[model samples]
Target: MSSEEEGCFVNILSRNISNIVDALLHGPENAFDEARKEGLLEREDLDRITNKESNGDKIRACLDIIEGKGNEKRICEKCGQEAAKRCVTCGILCCDQHLKRHQQEGHNLMDPGVKIEKLRCTVHGDLFKFYCMDDWSLICPKCKDGQHKEHEVVPMGTAPNKLKVVLAEKHCRVLKSIESNESQLHEVQEEEGQTQNAGRGAEDLLEKRRKELCQIVNETVDLMKGQINKRKMEKLSLLGKQKEKLEQQNESLHQEKSSLQTALQEELDTASFLQGSKDLLKRLETMSDFKSVERTPLPVLDFSKEEKNLDGLITLNKNFLEKIEKGPVEHPEKVELDQNNLRRLYGRSPSLDPNSAHRQIKISGDLRTATLTRTGNQYPEHPDRFDVHPQVVSCDCFSSGRHYWEVDVRSSRWWKIGICLNSMGRKGGKSGLGANPESWCLSKLNNEFSAYHNKQRTSLSVPGDHERFGFFLDCEAGELTCFGDSRVLHVFRGNFMDPVKPAIGVWDYYCDSVHFVHLVKQTFITN
Candidate 1:
């Protein structure tokens, strides 16, 4: 070949090799290494072309151009001034002074190749415009034909719009959840307010009831004192009568003795003296006997018995206050609720009747609590009072509908509380609460407890610390349920008679007492 032709061919080879080196250096560092690993190129050939360690400067230069830093120092080759723009056709930059001349000479100023190179894949060195759905990754056409051949793929430009749609949906759902939680919180707060108001009102009512009970007890004490005084006066009058009779007898005897002494002083003949002596002896025999005056014992007051009665009255008043304070029985759903909840849900507050309390059962002035006394109380004789057993009935009775009540059994170690028909026997015999056909009760004997009905007893497991017992009766449904600490202890089903009242019984044991939990209906208004 001619020398000129040879020189032209060598220049062409040098330009092509320079272009290849530029492309390799601008791409990812491991692009050539990956090609060799995939058997697409020989390792020695890739190493010879890339010369990774020796091309650090070239790599840095390529990075600077990709990041636009190289543009700061770029200058026009012909004018030796700052370049205004780059040309795509010849891969050259020109200043404003030379740009017009270059443009008029038909040079294309756009750099389409630069944009295309930016979209290239690091692994395959090919344009990456496809997205893989299965792998959640970006892919080139070559990758789609290789590892991602069967994967779900979409155009990369549309992927962002799809992701935005999903994000918006998730945001809306989170907003709804927040609103729902806020609404629930508001309801809870309002309920809390209602509860507080109810509690305040209940406290006021309890205080009022307590005061009334105290007043009644004071009056009872005053009445008892008056009776004691009256009885003392009557006994003293009887003692006075006895003394008068004894004084009269002493006078008569003294007169008789004086006559006998005078007759002895007169000296007489033996016969006359004998006759007078015989008459005197006869008179002495016929006269009433002389005896020393006997002192009578004065009537003494039994202070201990009076004090015991007073104590019993005080205890009864305290128990009555406790019952008024108890309010009502709340539904089982609110196990952790306050007693005010019971008042709001249930309408009746039951108190023990002082008139119905047994003689041995000392009832408080409030008529809500009762205790067994060593000495029986002198309570009024009422048909509802148990003459044989120490028991009392509540003043309230339920004939229909649902009713609930609670008993504070903390003071009663051996006691009984339950429902009883109004016709249940109260005078005597085996007709007391839980001991006859008309009564049912949950009873505690010492530490052990049981349920009794129709004289039959059923064993029960009682918690050691349980101080309160809740009873719910659906008279219409013939169902009764008992609860302790929110746990259902027993459920009884029976064809109970109408007009049933609460009954309480205590054995003749010391310190055994019971309080009927009090409840008022005004507090429960939450719908």
Candidate 2:
């Protein structure tokens, strides 16, 4: 063969090497031996191919050896052995071992030459030029026109690049999802920090209020001590003057008695003794006739009421502190109001009933202020009077409709302001404000505030001190709300079965007085 034909033959074998190796591994076992005898495969190459455990490994070994040898040879179609002669009639190659079989089949033979061809489609004998995406297979033009007509076919060169583009798009989507997750995590962390900051702000406000209340209490204590000391000194000075007058009268009496005794002991005549006795006896009689010094009662101070007040104050303070330490209550409801609107629409000024006042509770001339007094007023004994508790009720009563009122409570350290049924007990302890089912009240004992109803006391969250308190009663709605300086302190809900009257209680002497604020009519212009 010419050099050009030899080169063409080598190229065809290289392209069909996989098919050739596959056929050799499945066919005659002497193919490798034949290649080695032709000096195309070394002894080591034969050993490697023989040592492979699987047909696939042996095929790969044989292809490698064939690729390196570049031998110009043909494989017999019948038994996969190296071809030495060609069958002229069939245009197929045959080895010497298969030569007699072919001749007996009446086929003529010639020495083998370059007769290998390129791989072609088995069905149509056409070269493969396209890739079928549907079945991931290579197809020739004839195959594409036949069974692969409906498949997505593309040229062999662009199939891999299209798949790469799809993968890149999916990778971009994955990265976006990861970014979204990170953003959500950051939002959650920021919310947690904001919640912490809100808690800290509340804590700071509570601490500031606590300090203010403490200072108020300390100042009140100092004032009370000063007043008590002043009263004590005045009482002591009066008693001291009376004591000095009594001592002087006793000394004068002793001197007169000694003068009479000396006159009798000298053994003088009866005339002389009588003479001395006359003056001494006259002086003694004058002294005895002198009016006896009026005995002054000792100064006495009673603190039983104050002690009780302190006990109650201490209990209230303890409850308030415990509630504060536990943190703020959840869903705290605060009712906001326009002070002027409430005052103009529903404000009332109920006068205190002098007939219902306790003996120790003094009522001002205007009957709007109630004061705790040391001495009982000489009020006529009346059935409506509170015989046990130091409490008083308003003369005005309400059975329905809304009413609002304000009280000046700054003067009192311990006081109660509320409403009670007109028919409630007035002669026993149960008649006290908020002590029985007939009454409800908001009380302040020192720095602590609380709401009481039906003998149940609820600690309130109103911090510091408030000088004025407001009350709103909606009898038809069965609601009573208390406010400290316009801020809602507590609310009481109940069934108002009877007429209720405004009431006040002051049991401590230090609690000077509480006044009811009366609002007058006024007009205003709004823009």
| lDDT, residue 44, model 2 | 83
lDDT of 2 at 479: 82
Q: List the residue pairs that clash in candidate 2.
A: none
lDDT of 1 at 52: 52
lDDT of model 1 at residue 293? 40
Per residue, candidate 2 scores C-alpha lDDT tens digits across 361-466 of 9899999999998888999999999999888999877765567788888888889999998878899778889889989998888678889998899999887788
Tens-place lDDT digits, model 1, residues 23-125? 6667634544553454434455444445555565555433333323232355454555666655533445567887887567645453212332444577997
What's the lDDT of the predicted structure labeled candidate 1? Answer: 0.58
The TM-scores of all predictions, comma-separated, are 0.35, 0.36
Worst 10 residues of 1 by lDDT: 5-14
- Candidate with maximal lDDT: 2
Candidate 1 residues lying further than 4 Å off, grouped into runs, are: 1-343, 522-527
